[model samples]
Target: MKYIIGLAGIVLVFLLAFVASSDRKRIRYRPLIVMIVLQAILAFVLLNTGVGSFLIGGFASTFEHLLSYAAEGVNFVFGGLANVNEAPFFLNVLLPIVFISALIGILQYIKVLPFIIKYIGLVLSKVNGMGKLESFNAVASAILGQSEVFISVKKQLGAMPRHRLYTLCASAMSTVSMSIVGAYMELIKPEYVVTALVLNLFGGFIIASIINPYEVDPKEDILEIQEEEKQSFFEMLGEYIMDGFKVATTVAAMLIGFVALIAMINGIFSGIFGISFQDLLGYIFAPFAFLMGIPWGDAVQAGSIMATKMVSNEFVAMTTLTNATGLSARAIGIVSVFLVSFANFSSIGIIAGAVKGLHSKQGNEVARFGLKLLYGATLVSVLSATIAGLFM
Candidate 1:
């Protein structure tokens, strides 16, 4: 029964993408079919197999050690604020991003990341039937982040067409940055985070192919990465450390503001309508949750978290998911996978601004299709969660 519903959910996602497709005739079914099969196989391997357990365990253990090392820095700077037993969110969960970000910088500095990103992207381009630049952006976006990823391809930004630009932004919004993956592991099970990361990579392409289909002209398929200005090792390390701190502080501010605002709105709604705002959103999103194979009884709560992610951000939604009660393990796993992407209203502006900073005209093009980009990316998340449901 669950398998039937999961299959139906995939069909529903394709139908939604079809409705929004700019050129319905250009939608490629072959790659979409192949990718969907791959998603199922990967999800099964990652969620149900011994090998998957070993890999996820190893990945989780590595992050656990990294977070502990990061805690050493945090304790040195802000040692006495909290009690010994209590773990503060900002210190324990968010600040570790700084350490992870610096590690990413070291990898980038030594060119290890670029080498892996380029060759992996080349392999992906062959499978996805997209241009090398598009495949590279998707992989780079996962590692470097949405805004920073554009800097790597700044040379191609100005020359990119609307169709290609849409694909680029869609990939950025569908995957989370590697720098924050540790932060995410702190909030949810590591296996779900790892599964979502891999599934969303393929899911982004699947939805983009359907909604923004275009054949890359072989002659125009050039990929020129923008090289960063050379800096001494220490100089580069300091910059990434600062960048990581900024991201941590920025996320802290967003949580402070968004969590309070949502509380206020929930209070107002409860006062007037005898129900909370998120509960109302849950009611609206419940059907989609149901489609993802969450039990009908728990779908409303799961849907609310899914809607929270779309409206606010993944961090807020993950926090909510952690606090939520009465949800079955299956529903929790499905929603955890669903909340792993940057498919929120705010990301449209973030991606647009990132591009606009590089190429004004191209950034404007991104803003024009901002909502469509979010739509496709959200579908990508839904598709990933749905495929994951088949195995769970």
Candidate 2:
């Protein structure tokens, strides 16, 4: 029965994207259908089978273990203040990005990560029938993160057309950074995070192909990414370490403001209207939640989390999910998958600013389509969640 509903959800999501497609005649249903089937198969294997367990679960455990090493660094500096159970949220959750970012730098310096990204993306381009640049950007976004991914392709940013640029940003907005994957595992099930990462890769392409359909001219299909400026090993390591610290602190600041503001808004709503703000948003989003295979009884609560993710950010929504009660395990799994991306209000500005800093004109172009970018990425998250529902 759940599988039936899950199948219906996939159809509904595709229908929604099709309804908004720029050119129905130009829509490549073959790739769309292929990816949808692939999403379902991947979700099923990762969530249900032993192979999935060894892949997703093993990765999560290994990642969590890696994060423990970060804790040692945290303990070194802050002593008892870094113990997660006793430490503040930023201390335990956000600070570890510094270590992870350093590791990313080391991998890049050794040229190991680029080879993997290049090959995987080349393979995906064949399946998605998109340009190599698009495929590479999607995979790079997953690995390097949203803003950082743009730097990987900065040389081409000024030259690429708007439609291709949108696809790149959409991929960035749909996938979470590896640096924060551990923080996500701290909030939701690690397997769901891992699966969402995989599913969103295709989901971003599926939606972008429909909404921003444009053929990449053979002349513009170049995949020449600009390498970062040369630096000594320690010099590069120092830069990434500081960059990671900036990320951690920025996130901490945003959480402070957004979380507090949400509390205040909820207080006002409850005081005057006898309901919290999220509850009201939930009511608005409940039908969609139901269509995603959430039980009707839990739909409102799940919808609230969904609304929170769109209005604010995934971390805020995941925090809410952590404290939520009475939701079915299936609901938890589906919603966890849903909240695993950067498909929120704040990400639009983040992506735009990153581009603007590199190329002001191109950045302005990104801002012009910012809302639409969020729309496509949100659909990417919906597609992933719906497929996850099938396996759950």
Candidate 3:
């Protein structure tokens, strides 16, 4: 019965995703839509059913090749640093983020992402019915992060209509940068880098479209096809090193701030309530953990990690997962990756203000849609977790 309900929900979300169309301030999304239903079923099957166990095993088995690939990277860079059987945390976590960021950056130079943007933007153009510039920003922001991805379409940003600008800004705030993709893999599971990347791509596409879906009319002639020189392999490699520096620093900073904030919050809770803040958060998100297929015995302990992700960044959530001493294996995999995001409550203002930049005159609309985008992004990640839980 749980499986039945869960599977049914996935179907529902897919339906809603299709109907999530817009035209001039009127969202035509059919309630109980496909995307929402798909997400719901995914949560059920992954979290509530025994299916998660099987999926977890499958995820390992299927991604076995990744272990080999990862090993190759370790051997090339830091031989003896990685055990073939046990992927060392540093190699698995840090290197992937750095390498992938560079790889994506080089791809950006070659215009691969732009090509993808144009293709996706064309489809989104129909759903959003917005200017090419706005649609382009949406596609670019999803694959890349806020400031970096905007470089790809910087010209569009300055000239885009206010409503379209808001959409693009909302999308940037709603997603993570490519720079941190590898670290998430290291934290969740060495193999999940690919999965998280794919999921991030999907999450961005979905949320951007949802934000102010009916705000604009289409304009293609205004959109241009910009071209650029491909970087030589050495040049691209150099670019990665530069990008790696920036990403690593940003990640380090986030880790420091969030880690400190968690410590501060924990101190307060312990001082005032005479209980651990983690324990409180655990209970707060326990039902959600249960929904993600964690065994009832360890759900709240796991849910606290989810709470941390919602309040902080996914890195902090993964850090908590790694540091957590008594959690069951059942709680480990599903919760780690599922809780990964820039989905914290603090993101509400960050994303809104970012998008508000696009709308010089419509900061109010940007503010309203920013909240919706954050919720949508969080919901989609929950959907990611619930679905991934089944596979766990």
Residue 346 displacement (Å), model 3: 5.8
Residue 165 Cα positional deviation in candidate 3, in Å, after optimal superposition? 3.7
- Best prediction by lDDT: 1
lDDT of 3: 0.60
CA lDDT of each prediction against the hidden true structure: 0.95, 0.91, 0.60
In the range 148-253, model 1's lDDT, one tens digit per residue, is 9999999988878899999999999999999999999999999999999999999999999999999999999999999999999999999999999999999999
Rank ordering of all candidates by lDDT, starting from the highest: 1, 2, 3
Q: Please, what are the lDDT tens digits per residue for candidate 3 over residues 1-392?
A: 43543355344443444444343245435422443444445544544566744674565554454444544765698887656787655556655555566567677777787788788877755544455566566667656766455455544545555546555665565456655644565556643434443454445445445534544433433676444446688787787767775666666677788889889989999999997888899998787677656777888888888888877877778878888888877578667656655666666665555544544444455566555556666655655655555554
Model 2 regions more than 4 Å off = 82-87
Error of 3 at 307 (Å): 1.5
Q: Candidate 1 clashing pairs?
A: none
Worst 10 residues of 2 by lDDT: 80-89
Error of 3 at 281 (Å): 1.9
Q: List where candidate 1 sits over 4 angstroms from the true fold.
A: none
Please list the residue runs of candidate 3 whose C-alpha ends up more than 4 Å from where it truly belongs after superposition: 4-25, 30-92, 120-139, 159-163, 190-196, 199-211, 220-222, 225-240, 325-330, 345-372, 390-392
Model 3: residue 279 alpha-carbon error in angstroms: 1.9
lDDT score, candidate 1 = 0.95
